[model samples]
Each structure stands twice: as structure tokens, then as C-alpha cells.
Target chain A: MISPIGWFIIWLGILFDILGTIGLVRFPDVYNRLQASTKCVTLGTFGIMVGIFLLKGFSPMGIKALICGAFLLLTSPVAAHALMKGSLHFGTKMWKGSVVDKYGEDKLGGEQIEKEG
Target chain B: MRYVLYFIIGFCLWLLLTLSVNLDHLIVGVVVVLLGTVLFGGYFTDKPIKFLQIHRLFWFIVYIPVFIWYMFQANIDVAYRALHPERPIKPGIVKIKTTLKTNIAKVFLANSITLTPGTMTCEIDGDYLYIHWIWVQSELVDKASEIIASRFEKWLRRIFE
Candidate 1:
């Protein structure tokens, strides 16, 4: 039987997923949306994996969940980096309220526009 | 010696992936790790002794819990900004400099920054990293670096150096 703590952790993951979805809709622009989806959903998924591990203890499925947790930790940020680069390259535009644009000042920002991938 | 490190890592991965303890599986794991070590061990480190330093391993063990704590903090911080009624975000790309000298250290720093809340590493030029921060609390590079990287940098240096 799954313990109460395991169920609670699963609920927390669901909550985070819901918050991420809300963030995607509520945030001002693509960049903000990306932040919400990447950070929140990744953490939420990690939580679910941990919860599964808790429920299963040292069984094979539990060990698999732990491995998945490690993979999620390593890969999520790389995926976020790629998404940010692609969005910037395509000139998707940031929120007008944004206070700074270091990329706009850099030559690389414009260079990406002409290159074909 | 480097081959030993490679074998251990490879065996661990094999064990994790297969979740098996049969003699045939054990033999297969030994073969895979041996072949893998022959092919890739030297590529990871030229000085096996340096790479396997006890001090570095200790630091890595210490770092894991600290990193997890930071991850939790980051999630809460971002969740607050994402959910707040005002959405008090002052997003900006700020340049922050690193004291780390090695390429691997720099890579680790960049990945850590990207993972943490409020900041994302967009570009790295020499000693400077341009980060996209969700909340632009400070404009100074030193201040930004202190806020974003100070937690992870010292431990990373210990491990990578």
C-alpha cells in the first residue's frame, strides 16, 4: 500500500503541473511562458518520479524512477537553453515590460537571422 | 586507473538499466564496461589520479544536497513570480563574470545557472555570461554574479579543479 506521504507528494506534483499550465496562459509573452513551462513542469515531473519511488521502495520500478529523476535533472535545462536560443534567433519578441536586452546589443542576435539551419 | 573509474560508472549504468543479477548479465556488464573503458576512459581524463581525488569526491557528495536545496528554492521563487497577481517580473539579460578558468567548470556553471530560478544563461563570451533573469533586481555584474552563481561556483571549482 502507498503511504500517505507518497500520495501527498503526488498531489504536490499535480498542483505544480496545474500552476505551470496557469503560468503558460497568464504570463505576458513567449519568454515568460517558456520559463513557467520549463521550470514548473520539470519540477513537477521530478516530484512525480520521486513519489513513485517512495511508493515502490527499492523495487526495479522504483530504481527506474530514480534514474528518470536524474535524467530529468540533467536534460531539462539543456532543452530550455535550446528553446531560448531558437526563440531569440527567430525574433519571437520579449515582453515590452522587459527591462534589458543584452542580446539586442550583441552582434550574434542579428547574425542568426540570415543563417539557415 | 582511469579505466577503473570508467568500468565502475559503466557497470552502475548497466545495473541500473537492466535491474538484473544473473551471472550472464554480470558477465555482459563486465564485457561492456571493459570495452567502454578501452574506447573512452582516456577521453574523460588524462590524469586518472587527479580525477579520482578523494577531496573532489567528498566535495561532490557535499554538493548534491546543497544543489537539491537550491533547486527547491528556485522552484518556489519562480512559482511565486509565475502565479502572483501582479506577476512582478522585471525580465532582463545581464552580463555576469565567472572566476572559473576551465572549460568543464564553465560548462557546469552555465548548466547550474540555467537550472536555477529567476536566471537563465543565454550566452557565454569569454569570462562573461549573459543571463536572462526573470527579475532584474540589480544591474551590476558583480552583484548579479553573487546572487545567481555564488551558491554553486565554490563547490564546482572544488570538484572541477
Candidate 2:
């Protein structure tokens, strides 16, 4: 009884999920991969869950789907934030080609390690 | 009045999703939702509600599909990278400038950036977003900021601000 639109949305979600995974692989580092995975997967999952809800109507399954979607939306970004904070705390370096590091002077105390050493 | 409206909306949402009209559930839901609204009332200042245009809200619905499509593309990209044994990661932090002026829009952009795979909004100072990217694909930092402001900011401004 699922409408074509529902199926299409589900397919779109699947496609996003796949693309996010690919971005994670092709991306240069942990932070970049986190960016690729967290944003895309969260929204992608939401879309799929919405599709499921529409197809299943107001059944328990649909309710569970909605809950899952909400949980993902709420927690995924928080988790990403934690990961980034952890990486920064642990002294992860930026790529060399990176043009700007706004936090570098502030975060690293504005003292060049080479000069101090 | 706003609290009352919120309570009603919360109760209606609960009822619609739960699809239960049993007297016990209705009473409990109403009590809980009203209590939540009462608790939330303490957080807001006594400012009057800003006049929000209904037409602006409609754009959010239109933007949803675009967000979905972008998400789909990001998902596949992340999944493939994860499976790769080589783990071609270029990890780095980049400063991304944002045009969103309001706190809500900045929050939305930060959350949106975090939600997308391979990027995280590490910090937001004024109009700048300190984003950590997994890869530095060309001018990745500039691209990210532009993407956030252009793709999501306008819609979020419409919906919440």
C-alpha cells in the first residue's frame, strides 16, 4: 500500500546514506569524515524514517520509526561535537594546504613551537 | 498565551502520533504537556510574539527535499570512505565564514554542518565557523561555509527567525 512517493523518498534516503559513506572514504581526515557522515546520515535517516512512517501509517512500527528519527537527529550532532572536541584536545593538526586556522593562534597560545624550542 | 498555544500544539502532536482517545491517556497527556509548557515558560522573556508570516513557513516544506538530496549524496560518500582499507583521510581544521546573523540561524547552520558526514562545526565566533573537515579537497573550508550559508541558512531563517 505504499505510495510511489514514499518509495522514492526511501530510495533517496538510501542514496544519501551511501554517498555519506563514500565521502567518509574519500575525505582526507577524521574531521572531514565526521562532517561527511554526521550531517548526511542524520538527515538521510530522517528521510527514510519519514518514508517508513508514511507507508506504515500510525502503527507501532511507524511510531518506533519516528522515535528513532528523532533520536538520530538529536544525538548525531552532539556526538560529532564530542569527537571534534576530543580531536582538538588531543592536538590533531590541520592539513598543510589549509589556508586559514582561525583557532591556531588562540588555541595554540600564539607561540610557535619552533621558536620556543 | 504563547505557552497555552504551545501546550495545545504539544498535546495535539501527542494525540495524533499516539492516536489514542482513551480518557486516561488524554488526561495524562494534557497534564504532562501543560506542565512542560509551564516549566518552559520560565525560560522566555516577556517579549511579544513576533509576527511570523505563514507564507515564509511554506518555504521550509519546499527546502526539505533539497536537504534530503544533499544528505543522500553525503551519506554514500561517507560510507564508501569508511569501507576503504586505505582510509584516505586528509584531516584538518578550517575557518569558515558565515552570513547568518541570528543565533538561531547560526545554531541551525552548526547543527546542519555537524549532521552532514565528514565535517564538524568545532566553534562559532561571531560570523565565523571553525569547521573541522576530514579532507581538504581544494579550498574545502571556503566551500563549506558557502554551502552552509547558501544551502541551509536562507531556509532556516524563514522557518525559525
| TM-score of each predicted structure versus truth | 0.85, 0.73
Candidate 2 per-residue C-alpha lDDT over A1-117 given as tens digits, one digit per residue, 9 for 90 to 100 = 577777888887887777677766666555665677776677778889989988887787888788788768768887888887787667776544344454666576541112211
Worst 10 residues of 1 chain B by lDDT: B43-52
Off by over 4 Å in 1: A109-117, B1-4, B23-47
Candidate 2 C-alpha lDDT tens digits along B72-142? 55565566666678865555556778777767567767877765545667888788877666565544657
lDDT assessment of candidate 1: 0.80
True contacts kept of each: 0.59, 0.52
TM-score (0 to 1) for chain A, all models? 0.87, 0.86
Error of 2 at A52 (Å): 3.3
lDDT for position B104 in model 2: 59
